[model samples]
Structures are given as structure tokens and as C-alpha cells.
Target: MYQKENSSWVKHADFTICDMLCLQLAFILAYWIKNGVGHPYETELYRNVAVVMIFIQLVCTFFNESFSGVLRRNMLEELKKTFEQCTLVCLLVLVYMFLMRVGSDYSRMILLVSYVFYIGFSYCSRQMLKKFLKNRRYEEGEKRSMLIVTVSSNAKNIVETIRKNNYGTYHLAGIVLMDCDKKGKTIEGIPVVAGSEDIISYIHKNWVDEVFFAVPKEITIPEQIIKDCSTMGVVIHMQLATMKSLGKNQIVEEVAGYTVLSSSIRIVTPRQMFIKRTMDIVGGLVGCLFTGIVALFLVPAIKIKSPGPAFFSQVRVGKNGRPFKIYKFRSMYMDAEERKKELMKQNNVKDGMMFKMDDDPRIIKGVGHFIRKTSLDEFPQFWNILKGDMSLVGTRPPTVDEWEKYELHHRKRLAIRPGLTGMWQVSGRSDITDFEEVVELDTKYISEWCLKLDVEILFKTVMVVFMGSGAK
Candidate 1:
């Protein structure tokens, strides 16, 4: 997470704002240069047209990663990207003009001249801005600090590799020796300040930006130590000779020519994620409208039958181990939680990490069975999604007690936000009683995720809900 923020290609909001400003100015300047001052400025009309044109170009720029190259360092690459963006922007505007049958309203010569000025000015502005930022960072004495974790035997090779590909982004601050007697030794001018046993304390006391684990194959780092770094929000890099141990889901990224495996739970593209969130917002609003109507009858029915609150909420673990209340319409008796302990032995799940029973005595008679079958009890969760506590499709949230019993590997499923419905809900949920199988399915959904997959699962869920195939 920290590395993502410090990446050289990460675009800045100021840079984007300046980029748009430069493009707009270039358009006006081109108009004046081509048609002379005799032509009316059309300030209002042209400004509006420029705004719409810039918006389209921004979309095209993002898709093409036009702003993803280091400006001052990669002038040639930046030039190429600038040309590509300019050509794409022109093509899109032409397509729009043709589609709207307004091609004759705009002058083709002005566009051609504007493209030339836009490309030239954009590249020059970026280069100047890059120099300004470089001077500022130099004056402030800011440099990305790195702490290398390796044995004395391989420290030289790691240091050399870093030097070869560093690209002026990182400078070694210190080294933590692993399985070595050289605690006070120096490796390539950097002092080996601590051994494996004292590494955690060193990390806590030092201002380390990144920790690179470059140990030998046989020497395994403790899982708790890794988790500690993650909890501290420090970026970690692990260099491996082979990818056999790390799962295939890992993405291999090169840093200064050194290859390392990087893993993330949300592997889908940013555009897809944005669309998913938009869908969730839209779906949540619609669901809440339906909930308002359903509550008219549900509130009366549930209260008259069970003599308790019409809704139920429980503490559930969300993404990154945060806790939040998950709301649901009352589908069980008021004493359901109290009676759960006595019914523990009745749990049907084989490798039990969760409790489930086909004929639980706690349910609120007819209303419970009907709502559970129809999935109407889950309607209240739309509020959770709208509040950003959950998603429209993700792994089901685990209860507090269930989370407490989780093993180290079991927590992998918590990397993403919990969802109202997911692969488990649509895929014979009641028939599957093994906790391990549930984890497998959740992991599979994350690894194979895409916008289309979410839509497909949602469609299957509607069918399952209507048929009452997977509810108990």
C-alpha cells in the first residue's frame, strides 16, 4: 500500500489539473492563431466545448496510461504517450462530430492546429513541472528509504541488483541480517544493525519506508513478523528464485530489475471496481425503496408473532478486521443467540467453523420460514452496502465468534469487504456444510472476479431465491 503511493508513475491531482488547463489554453491559442482576432471569440461556446472535449480526452488518457511514465527521466517515452493521447483525443472528437452530424460546425483545420499546439505545450509543461518537483524534493532532503533483510552471504548481490535498477527512487537505510554471525558487519557500505531476533524492534524504532526480505530458500521468515509489518502499514518486498511456493494468483513485479511476487485481494481493474461500486450504490437505493414497502407488512407480522424488535443486527468482521453491525429483518426468536450454545452439537457443518442447522427451534414460526425462503430477511443489508460497510458481491461477513476461531490461513478471505450476496449464496449454499469448501469458493470468486462474473452470479442468485433452492 505504501509503495503504491510512492510509485513513480502515480499521477497527481495537481498534475492532472494543470494538464487540463494547458490543453484548454492550447485550444484557445490555436483558434486565435488560425482565424486571427477578426473572428468572434465565442468565449462561452468554446469554453463549454473545450470542457466536454477535455472530459472525453481524460477518459481516453486513463485507458491508455498516457500519464504513467516518469516525465523528466523518460522524455522520449513521455513524448510518445503525448502523441498517442493527442491522436486518440482527435479521433474521438471526430467520431463524436460524425455521430452527432455536427462535423461541419467545427473547423477541421483548427483541430489539426490545436493538436500540434496541445502536444507541444503538454510535453513542455510536464517536463518543467518534473524539474520543479525534483528541485523541491532535493531542497527538502526527501528520498525513499529502504531496509534490506538478508544474510551477509547474499547482501552484496542484493545491493548490486538494487543499484542496477534503483532509478533514483530508493536509497538503502539499513540491513537486517538473517541467519548470520555478522551483526555489526557492513554489506556494501550499509551497516548490518540487527539480526533476525532483533529485527522487529529495529523496525519499530526506525523510520523505514520499505522492508525487503531477501533471505535464502531454506530460511523462512515468521508469519507473525510479516503480519506485524503489514499492521504497521509498511510495504514489504520478497525476492524469490522461483514462484513455486507463492500461489499462481500472485503478480510478479520488477523493481530496479529485481523481480518479486506481489499479491492483492482486489485484482480487478480500477474501472471495473468503479463500475461495481456504482452498481452497488444504485442497487442499494432500489433495495432500500423495496425494503420501505416490505417493512409495512413485515414489521407488523414479525412483532405480532415474536413480540420483539422487527429487525436484528449483529457484529460481523468486515474487510481488514474492522467490525460493523450487519442488519437483517428478524427471522428468528428473540432468544436465538442465548439458545445457540445449547444447540452447538447440532451444527451440521462437518469441519465446523460456523453454526448451521436445518430445523432450528429458534426461528419465528411461519414468518421466519417464509422470509428465510424468500431471502426477504436480508433486505436490510442494503443499508450496510449504501453506508460503505459492505459490497453488493463479495465473501459473506463472518460473525465475531466465527472470526475468533479462524486459523491464520482462514483470514485470507477477509481481505475484501463482506457482501450481501456472493458465489456461496447462489451455489447450493444449504447443501454445502463444510467450512473449508466455503473458504475455497470465496477464494475462487476473488481470483476469478470480473464485472461480468458479478452480473452472472447476481442473475443466478435471483433464480435461486425465486426457486428457494439454496435457503434454509
Candidate 2:
């Protein structure tokens, strides 16, 4: 599959971290220049101030997107951007000092000197890092290959544009001519590799990871070619750099060195995803600890009641249909799988896309009923969250058989990683019996996912668990 370039701060974190380091170096130098001190941060006052400054740096660099285009900026641009960011950090610190009435406690000269030194240090480091990154990522050797498709008339301009604005991740593999064969011909020295008829064959034999289509307004891309590329797991990005939003599910993204229209289930910033994953890791760690404790107390009782393994493992579909072994406390008898077929008639869901019954006959009566009611059966999934097979909040994972029976539309719910608790789980898990309603809630969660929405869902999940009403 075309490994979509990493979505977030992961791509440009080096510069952000380097800039913060530069500020620390600047502060150290400023301290020495002003007081000839051995270590400013060793003092309680300066140590506390240093911590606050670090927070300000985070706010300025990450939250404020100060390094949004760091890799693409030229030396002069980097100088301007870095200087502006450093000034902003100092200004925020100044406001903090003023508000706390501690202006007299801190040395103004040290602050001014730190700002000046930070601007110079950060700019140089950023420019050098950017150059090094461009060399390593784009020019060192082989990179992800990109194939450009367009009419012969538009080939030269599109090639020039891609070269000018390429994010340096994809090297031009060659071109494919739609209007006519220009095979063995070079547009801006990028050879025309194929023409309309043989493009698919050429791609089949080549290592093209992504395709960029930049046809004229009047021309249309062949549906067959698009399907052929997609079937081979190659992403086709249509050049739409000069336009604005293209409505729902259409995202304007920079791909293969060109701004293209990428259709996706959701479009969110890398920073937000970074934060979301961070939250998952933190929550997963805590959940695992609690799961261990709960298991100690619950496992023996479960074993005593059912006389089977305390843990249950089943292969379940995860994000994008990737399969993983999902774990839950053994909440049902050993023969539950075999018994499910006979029990299908009693399913609560109208369409039977999902299996839920009023009181599952297979549950190990007392212990199973208690765990399911308390939702403790799902605690083991915290390990899945840590492994990234799941998220803390997402669509419920369907059993392998249920997944196999799903219609095309139902697959959208699994576009994201399955979660321990989710929209449907929080929205009256037992009452909402319609599988379509489950799909609706899951898709709504995916489409409208944000930190705020996730927070609200998490809070509601806590309430639901405490109230003892979960999956029927």
C-alpha cells in the first residue's frame, strides 16, 4: 500500500526541539554574560522561571504552529520566522512577569540578551537543519517515486511547478502522456515513460508510489486508469493547489510535491493526532495497571464460575480491516462461539448485522453477568490500545464473522481503529439495537472527532460504566 507520509509533527519535530534547545543555550549564555553565573537554573527562582519559559516555548512552537513550514523556508524566511517566534516567547514571558508583579525580580537585560541570542541561534540551527533534511530526504539517494500524468501540452508547466514546490519527499519518477505518446522524450529533463494505452503496464512494472494528475480543466481522467492505480495500491492525487475546499470528504493536501485533492474519511492536523495518540498512550498505561488489579480480583471468580481460561482471545478486525487478536475477560462459557449460531434468532439487533441478545445464554451466569454489567470484561483491551491495534475511543470492533457479513456502507465504521469505549457504547449501548444506528454513531464520531469530542465521549463513557449499562 502507498504508505501515506506521516501526518503530523513527526515530520518536522527536529526543528521544534532544536529551537527550544537554542533558547536554553541562549539563556545560559545570557546568564553568564550578565552575572558570570555557574548555573542559572540551579537557583530556585531561575529554575521555576525556566520551567515556565519551557511552557511558553511549547505554546509558541507547537500550539501556535510557529514551525508549520520550517522545512520549506529559505534561510531568510527561517530567519524571519524564528525571530518572530523567539520574540513572541519573550513577549509572553514579559506578560507573565508583569501579571505576576515580578518584573523587578527578573533581570530585564538578561531577558533582552536571551531574546537576541535566541533569534540568532535558532535561525542558524533551523536553516542548517532544513538544508540537512532536504539533502537527506530528497537528494541523498532514492526517495518515494512520483509519476506525473497530464496532457503533453501541460507537462512542462506541471513539471516546473512540482520541482519548485515539491516537499522533497518524492522524486519525479517520470511522466505519462494522455494526449499523445511522447515516450523517450523529456519535459524539463524528466523522461516521458509511457502514453495513454501502456500507462498501466508501465506502472505495474515500476515502483511508483504515488501518481499526480494535472490535466487541463476541460480534460477528464480515465476512470479505468484511476481504478487500475487504486487496485494496485497507488494513490492518485489530482492537482488542485490553486483552489480552496472541495466540499465534504475532499481534503486539500500536499502530496508528491504538489497540492492535490485527497478524498478521505476525515482530515485532521498532525498535531491533533499527535495529542490524541499521546492521550491514548497515557490512558492505556493507566488502564493496563487497573486491568491487572481487576484481573487479580475477577479472574479467580470467573474461573470458579465457568471453569475455562480466565482470558478470552478472538481475532477481530481493526483499523482499515487489519486483523488482530482482541482480548477480553472470559465473560462467556467456553462453548459460546458454538452456541452463538443457535442463538442468532434471539438477537436484539433488527437486521442482525450485529449479534446481541436480551440475556445471552452462553454467559457464565453469575461472573459473566457481573463483568459484562460492570463493563470489566473489556479492561484487557487496554493492552491493545497500547499496541496501537486500537484507540481509547472509536468504533466497536466487529467479530470476524460479523465483519465478513458487513455491507459496503458498514465498512466505513472501521475506517479508524476500534476502541474500548465509543459513541455507540456511550449512547445507550443496550437500547440502540439497530446496527445502522451503531454505524451512524461510529461514523459521526470519526467525521467529527476532535480533542473536545473525544473528551466529551470519555466523560460520558465513565458515566455509562458507573451506571452499569453496556453492550447487551
Candidate 3:
């Protein structure tokens, strides 16, 4: 079911390598300019260090989202991300030097100059390349191949937007109707070739480069349609309630080994799975390394105050409705679960399924309040992440009891693995009093989940933890 597009992977690979080489050369030039006659030193150690540093920086640059959707990115956004990535690289270099105990070996002056020059030159290079590509595509009459997969008013609006924009780059290939009633007709001059059932056949027959889905959310097509399109090697775009409501940062993921249709902005990609796993491994290892030290200090304090186990384990719903034991530093009394029923009448929250009490009396003595407030209770979940029952970022898993109460729609949150921290946790854990709001946020996160989003959430999570905002 695969067909080739005008752009080839070879071209992409060549462009990627060229960009990397250009950046490397820019770094080298900056180094020379900064060090002058001492530029070409004969130290093998320095050369080895330089190679390793450059490789690490390049990888980090990619991870920080330096080279993504190069064609469609806005210049301003690209520049901002570039500046941030450059700063990150500089900081890494400083950290690397400190760790290696060789801060004196490398010239600080050279590093500073390289940082400035590399950032400016790299940004300019990307901008110039973007403009050049845009011009070339225009000159070559390289129109963006697009296929509309709906016959709704939303589809009409999408057509209107494409028409009004008049960028001359996008060419409407055809439209596929979600409902069979509109089959064998044309909408606004775009041919309605087939229905959702025949979309695979239609795509195979046509030279479609991109597929635009404007189908209503009520439609019950198998999620496989999106995955089929992705596996068939086409870029898929969907129109949600409003453009603003669309999380541009939502990630497209392959569910059940098939790519599901998702919004453009995502937290995880097939390409990023490796990096995410690596991060989980490294982060988990580091966390495990400190687990003993933390347990030692906190265990006795908790026992002294609460007279209970130092750790708490509870059954939480994980990916695919699976139940798993989640570990935490015991933040509540031994009989906290038993006391939940007694406090139900005093519950200030009113949500469909979730239970919450801002001022619950179930908390343990000294450490319970402190640990819960700072989210130190969640640190042990790093073991869960390491064990692959969870991730560094994903929807928060519900309690087993909570899972039993979930509606079918809410079960969609289990479509992906649960996380240690998530959008809901960072946004407003305690303040977000509505269970539906929590589910909505989770759905939003899943629909638009990506590695970048994970990174952003992790960053926000750090801020939230430090600020102790919305913690109970």
C-alpha cells in the first residue's frame, strides 16, 4: 500500500548531514577565531574530547527539537528553539568540563566565542535553507499533495482555508467521504472518490502526499485508518473543534504497532522512542542510585511521626486497563484507605469518578504533609518507569477502584502507558476539581502526546514541584 512522494528520504538524509556538517564547520571556525594560533593543537585527548562533545551536542540538539518539520516551521519559533538548544549545549559543555575535571585544559574564551558564533551562524544557515527550499519548491512547481477525507461543513471550511491562503504550494488531490451518502460526487470542485471504507484503495490509486481528516468525532471508523495511512507513508492532518483547540504540539503515535491519526504537535514519535527509553533508563538509574540515601533519611522520620511502613504500595490502573502496584513513600496513615469512606461526606470535590479532599485528615504526621506537598511521594515510581510499567511522561494512572468506575470514553486514557508526571499533575492537581476536566486533559495529552510535550511537561513538572503549587 506504499507509494513514493516527490521528496525522498535520501534527500532528507543528505540535507540532515549537510546541515550537521555546516554546523560543525561553523563551530570549528568559531573555535579558530577564538583561539587564534592555538586552534590546531596536537593533543589527542583534546581531539577525542572535541569529537565526543560535538557528537553529544548534535544528539542533544536533535533531542531538544532542533531539526523538526524544517519545511513548515515558523522562522521566529525556529530561532527561539535554536537559541534555547544552543544555550543548552553550552551548559552541557560546562557541565562536561566540570565532570571531567579538565576545566583548565580547554580555553573558556574559545568556548564562549564558539557559543556565540555557532548560535548566530546556525540560525542563519537554517533560515537561509528554509527560504531556499521554499523558493526551489515554488520554482519546481512542487505542489503539496493533499487529500480531504470528509464531506462535512468542517471539510468545506478546510477547503476554504486552503483556497483563501493561496500559497500555491498545496494541490488538492481529491476528497474521501466519511459517510457513503456523498460518494461519487465532488465538493467545491474536489472529487469525492470514495467513502471511509474505500479510503485505502483510493490512497493506493492516487499520488496523495498528505491526508486531511475533517470527519466528525462521532464517526466510528476503526483507528486503523489513521495507522494505515501512516504506514502507507503519507502525512495525515486532522481538523478538530477549532484551530486554537488543536494542540499543535500533539504527537502522532502508532497504537498497536500501527500509526494512529494525531495532531501535528506530539510528545512521542517512532523516531523518539529510543531517546525516551534512554532517558527513562538513565533517569531511572540515577534515581535508583539515590533511593537508598533518600530512604535512609526519610524512613526513620516517617516512622517516628506516623508509626507505619516507610513505603506505600497501591494498585493503580496502568496501560490497557492493567493493574499494577505503584510505589510511593507512605504519605498517609496505615488506615487512610479505610478512613476514605468516613471522610466522603466532607468531600469538597464533586467529580464523576475521582475522589479528592483538599483538607483531608488521612495524612500521616510530619512527613506525610511535607512529602505530599512536595510530591516526594512519587519519587519511587522511577522504579515503575524502569520496570516499563510507566514512563517519565504519560497520563496519570487511576486507582483500581477509580478504573472500575471509568466510562468507555475515559478508558481511552489507558491507550498509552501511564506516567510518573503528566499534564494534569503539572497543570493543577488539587485545583482542578473536576474529574471530567482531568479526563479531558488526559485525552488532550494522548491525542497530542509527543517527546517535546513530554520534555515540556517534565520541565513544567519541575517548576510545579519546586513551587509546590496545587499540591495536596
Strongest candidate by lDDT = 2
Tens digits of lDDT, candidate 2, 107-128 = 8898999999999998888878
TM-scores for every candidate against the unseen true structure:
0.51, 0.55, 0.68
Residue-pair clashes per candidate: 1, 1, 14
Quote the RMSD, in angstroms, for model 2.
12.5
Report the error of model 2 at residue 209, Å.
Answer: 34
- CA lDDT of 283 in candidate 3? 79
TM-score between model 1 and native: 0.51
Q: Model 1 over residues 419-456: C-alpha lDDT tens digits?
A: 88888878877788988888888888887887667888
lDDT of each: 0.81, 0.86, 0.76
Worst 10 residues of 1 by lDDT: 133-142
Q: Point out the higher-scoring one by TM-score: 1 or 2.
A: 2
The 10-residue segment with the lowest total lDDT in model 3 = 2-11
Segments of candidate 1 deviating more than 4 angstroms: 1-262
CA lDDT, candidate 2, residue 409: 86
Ranked candidates (TM-score, high to low): 3, 2, 1
